[model samples]
Structure formats: C-alpha cells, structure tokens
Target: MENSLEFAQQLDRTDPLQSFRKRFYIPERNGKPLIYFCGNSLGLQPQTARLALDQELVIWQQHGVEGWFEGENPWLSIHQRCKKPLAQIAGANPSEVCPMNNLTVNLHLLLTSFYQPTPNRSRILTIGGDFPSDQYALESHIRNRGLNPDETLLEVFPRPNEHTWRTEDILTAIEQHQNSLALVLMSGLHYYTGQVFDMAAIAQKAHEIGVPVGFDLAHAVGNVPLKLHDWGVDFAFWCSYKYLNSGPGGVSGVFIHEKHHGSNLPRLAGWWGYDEARRFEMTKGFVPMPGADGWQLSTPPVLAMAVHEAALAITAEAGMEELRRKSELLTGFLADGLQETATVEIITPPNTAERGCQLSLRIKTGGKTVFNHLTGQGIIGDWREPDCIRLAPVPLYNTFEEVWRVGQAFADFTS
Candidate 1:
C-alpha cells in the first residue's frame, strides 16, 4: 500500500460518495467540526429528519383521528411501509420483517415465540462477549421459562489471552453440546471487537443440531450485507440507530424466516399482532398476521416510523451493495492507516469479511490517556471498559477525510 497518510488523502479526494459528508451535523471543536467515527453506537441524525417528522406533525394537527387512515404516511400502514425497505436491508421477504419496539423489547418478543425450550434441550448458546442488553435479554428469557439462566445459558468466550473468538472454537462448542442447545443466539457483528461472525455457517451447523438460530444485528444490519432467509436463520433482530442512520432509540425490526409463516405457536400477542384484516374487529380470539408482524404487541408508532422511513429512504437510494462497497474502502482506509503506526493496535479482525465498518483499538498503554486525548479534541469514538475503543466510518454520511483525520489523531497520540 502507499504511505498511509497520502493514501487517506487520495481516497478522500477520489471517493465517489464523498459529497454525503455535508448532509450531517458534525460537531465543531473550535470552529471546525470534528470527525465522527462512532456510528456503531448511535448514528448521526439525517438532515432530512426534520422535514419528514414535520410533515407527520402537520397531518396529525390537521386531521386528528383521520390521520390514521390519511396523510403522506398513513398511521395504520406506516409500519408496513417500512417493512419493504427494511426487508431489503435484511435480505428477507417483506412478510418476514416488521419494525416496532426498541431492540431489547423486540428481542423479548421474538424469544417469547421462537425460544421453545424442551426438557432435554433447554439451553441457549450465545457469544461470551455480547452487548450487555443481549446478555440481559437471554437471562430474562431463560428465567422466564422457569429455568435458571446460569444452568441453561452457555456463553462461549475466546481462548485465554485472545482478543476475539474464533469460528472454529464456536463451532466446536456447538458440536459438543448439540443435544442440549435449543437456540444459538449471536450478534451478526460483535459490538466491542467488530468481528462479523460467520452467520451462515453457524446457522447451518445449529440447524443440523435441530437448534434454532437468531442474531442481534444492531451493528451489522446496515454495516454488512445480511441474508437471514438464505442463511436459514430462524429469526433475527436489529436496532436502526446504528449503521442504518436512524436516530437514537429509533424503531427496531425483527425477521422470521418465511418457513414460520403459519406455525401455530403461542406468541405474546396484542391487537396489532393480530391479523390486520380482523385487527379492528375486537374479535373473540387473537388471530396472528403471518411472519414477523405477528410479534408486534401494540399499535405502530407513526412518529418513529416516519424517522425510520426518512433514514431508510436514503439507504434505499444508496443501495446496500453500494454502501458496502464504500464501507469496505472507508474502513479499509482507516485500518490500513492505523496499522502502519506503531502506537495503536487494532483489536478487530484484519479480514474484511470478518468485520464491518467498525474498528476496535487497544492502545499500547491501555486506552486511558489516548481516550481522553481524542475526546478532548472533540472526536467522538467511545471507550469500552478496560482498554478497548471503537470507531466506525459510516459510509452514508462519514467522509474519507474524516477517517484520515482520525488516523492522524491516533498517530499523534501514540507518537
């Protein structure tokens, strides 16, 4: 590769999607706004969000109850409107996807239906280093089933002294407890390390063991290309606040493979989850809509759906494949630049297929001083416990120049 600094500058000048950088709210340090490379946590708000939200507000004011059936975004069908684009993003059939509650809430709803633990196979196999919310969700699911979380939940961690878990080790664990494992739940891309797990392989293996597989795609949904249906995954959930460019606490989505469309499983159902054709009838018994929409427990939030539509409209315009193409270049540029410097060490996997736009760095001196230094300069990468710091270059809005600046900032700190 060319010299790291020169290459970063060159990439910036030539980036086809570089013009998108001006569309976000970059924070100003002194006069100039600092580079944002933390889209893995909460993505920056789109500049178009205001207009989209305002349109909804105006309709609500002008129409009142009539807004439910009328407006640019009719309240009753807003969630359904989001389903098509979200399905495209997740690589699933539109009937298999739905946007509703937040990430953990959706997870609970999915687990309530999908996780049917029997006597012999009551255990859940999850990654050792999942995000705290995922861990909590698993614990709740296990306990809610009248089983002990510690006894039924198995967390597979990396070998001692290793930075990330290996695929071989994970598969080995699955093979060992194949009989007891009822579900294999994992993050599509790990939050701290940014390691994109081999979901297809894992799901294939889990299915062989008769174990249903689910994934939390919070960091992976927009950051990497997903094929949940083709991967044979039974179910999956994701938050839009990350790489999807949806604002913080934005609506989350879930996917249930088309195979589960008419299954007569007992789900925690509500009015919206009932068949839409009969939803307003106040019928005697609950009737479910096919696929993931059956998981919704309450009415759709039109305001949140508007925000999701606005953000996803941008993603839809910039096709996921194209976003991924820019993402590979942007993240590759950041990785290439940082690896050339001696002071910074990347904890995320080096292989492009093993990671997304996120790169987790462990400073030579454990991250304390370096983290403070970067935040002081108005750079907004987050620090995890211990020494890891995560930075993400969101292709939709982050620029190649910002990636270079972040590298320079890290190089300066380490030097």
Candidate 2:
C-alpha cells in the first residue's frame, strides 16, 4: 500500500490477472506503450477483434447470402454468440440479454415501451446530470408522448455545492415524487463524477412506490459488479466500446428482466424481433421472440457482432469478481499516491463501493497545463470540460506500474 515504485512493481508481479494485460493492443508513443488511462471513453482493442472480423468477412465472401444459414458460426444466429458472455457480465439469464443496437438507440427503444404514463402518474424521475443523450431522450420522449417536459420530467440534483448525490437524498427524492412518478430512469454510474449510484437501493425504492426502474449502465457495466436480474431492475442498456473492449461503435447490450418476457408490453418491433420459429413466414403481425431478443428492431450487424463477440469472450474469461478486485486496488493505489500532491482535488467519491476504477481530478491551478504535462510524458488520460481530468485504470490491460507512473507524473508536475 506504500506510495512507492518498488511497491507498485511488487503488486503488479503478484497480480493473478497480470497476463490479461497482454490480451489487448496498447497505443504507443515513441515506440513505447503509453500509460492509457482512458477506458471510460474507449477501451483498447482486444487482440482477437481483428481475427474475429476477418472470419466474418471470409464467410461473407465464401458463402454470400448463404452465410446467414451456412458457415460454422452462421450469420442468422450471430447474435447468439454474444449472449452467454453478456449474460455472465450483466448477471442475467441468456434469454434476458441481447447485444444489439447503439446505446442511445436501445435507450430510446426501451423508453418507448417502458415510459407509458397515465394521467395520475405522468412524470419521469431522473438524475439531474445524466449523460446528455439520456437527458435528450427523456425530454424528447416526454414531449412526443404529449407530456410537457417542464411538468412531467422531474430531476434530482446534488445538495448545493456537492459534486455527487447522496443515497438518502436520492431515496427521499424518489419518495417525494412517487405519487406523480411513472418511471425511474437513471445511470447506474454517474459518467462525469465517476460515482457509482446505489442502484440496488434506488431500484428497491422505485419499485416500492409502484414505479418501473431502469438504469443506463454505460460506465458501470464492465467497470463494476452488476447483478441486474437479482437486483430486480426492470430494464437496462450499455455501450460495449468502453469497458467491454469492443472497437469503436461496437454493438450495445440490452437487459430485460425475465418477469417482463411473457407480458404484452408494447415494444418498437421489426422483422428481426419476430418469433424465430416463424421469422421466414413474414407474417402480418409482429410476434416478438421470447425475452430481450424480442426488443430488436433491425437485422443483425454481423461485422460489428464479430468484434463484440470476441471482446466479450475475453471479459467473460477474466470474470467481473476478479476484474473488480484488481480495479479497487488499482484505483485506490493511485488515489493514495495523490494524497502527497496538495493541489489536486478529487471529485469522485472516496468509498470503494461508490466508485469503479475512475478518478475525476479537479486540479486547483493551471489544470490544463498539468494535463498537458502528463500527456507530454506519454501518460495519456482524458480532459473533461470546465475543469476535470478523468483517468480510468482499466484492470484488463492497465498495470499497477502505469498507475504508479501517473502518480509520479502528477508528483513531478509544477502547474
């Protein structure tokens, strides 16, 4: 636990998951791998991703349209390859998970089905500062449903100057709005602050008030431990490009609790979601396939699915419990080291359970210069607007040494 290079090297040498770092292609500067602490924005490319895409290309060239039903991993069932891994990652039954669509697309589609408001309870309650897309989707969807955004969209903000929301404050807000609330939509993890919301508690309180609850797990999915099914979450969606290590714009994953599978809940349907047994019939009515797959709105994207499937396989192998264990140690190590640097203000919560691997630092003076200094040293992290540097030490590919070097970079910086 010492803030020393020797200790950091010792931790890396003993990490059981040490070899997993070699599984991805790290970006380079001056022929050396950069300390890439940006998994929150996008993960490094998995070594297997290219080969997976090539296999699909070969199938496309060799079998043409027949590839849908032919080949070892047929295009028709391409989505199935990702199911088992996604299920393991999301803590859901395979039938309840589907890796499809972009994150925002799934958010809108899920909202279309889940955001049914009645006159007595017409409002949607959400965190005040969720990701911009989620904010837009809720506002526009409310308006499209003929509800006034100003009246029907309720938001809960942090108390006064606080950077993160308190669990009690969130629970109180839910109870205050319960009588008028129809749905609770929130991000499992706050993207900007790197705070992990108390999802289980939030879901419980929402349901107790007879409201449906859903989470946008863009930052929480692979970065934290999630038991979506057991937690009684009604629905959720996430992008795979971040912690899942899929290439940019990779297929996103969706989760619908098994309890909703048989219900006649309205969904935006397409031929892909048609009952698998009778898909070719192209019947007049849209009979959705059982479980989360029923929400699909378009045909499978095989090329994207290939890379996604490959990336998820590696995650499944590494396992969330192991990844999270390493993540806590990795993130804590850096946080501890920063205590020696007096000028940096950490906005992310200090509790281990309340955050993943990300540390959102607010530099007191010349923040941008400090960021530039780190970047010049080949220690690459991202700079967020206003004034904050978001650094995520991904356990899958990032080493403890990298985390230590970042601390050293901060220690040596003058600005």
Error of 1 at 314 (Å): 0.9
Residue 109 error for model 2, in Å?
0.6
State the lDDT at 98 in candidate 1: 92
lDDT of 1 by residue, 1-415 (tens): 4535667678778877777766667766779777787889888888888888999999989999999887566798888888888888999999999998889998888888778899999999998878999999889888878999989989999889888989988898999999898889989899889999999999988988888899999989988999898999999999998888778889999999988888876688888888888888898888888778888889877788888998887777777898888888888888877886776789888888898999998877757888889888778899987888889888887877777778778778767
lDDT of 2 by residue, 1-415 (tens): 8988899999999998999989999999779999999999999999998899899899889999999999677898989989999999999899999999999999999998899999899899888978999999999999998889989888899999899999999899899988899999999999999999999999999999999999999999999999999999999999999999888998898999999999988888988999989999867988889999999988888999999999999999999999999999998999998987887989999999999989999888888988999999998889987789999999999998988898988988843
Predicted structure 1: lDDT: 0.85
TM-score of each: 0.96, 0.99
> What TM-score would you give candidate 1 relative to the actual structure?
0.96
Residue 97 lDDT in candidate 2: 96
Best by TM-score: 2
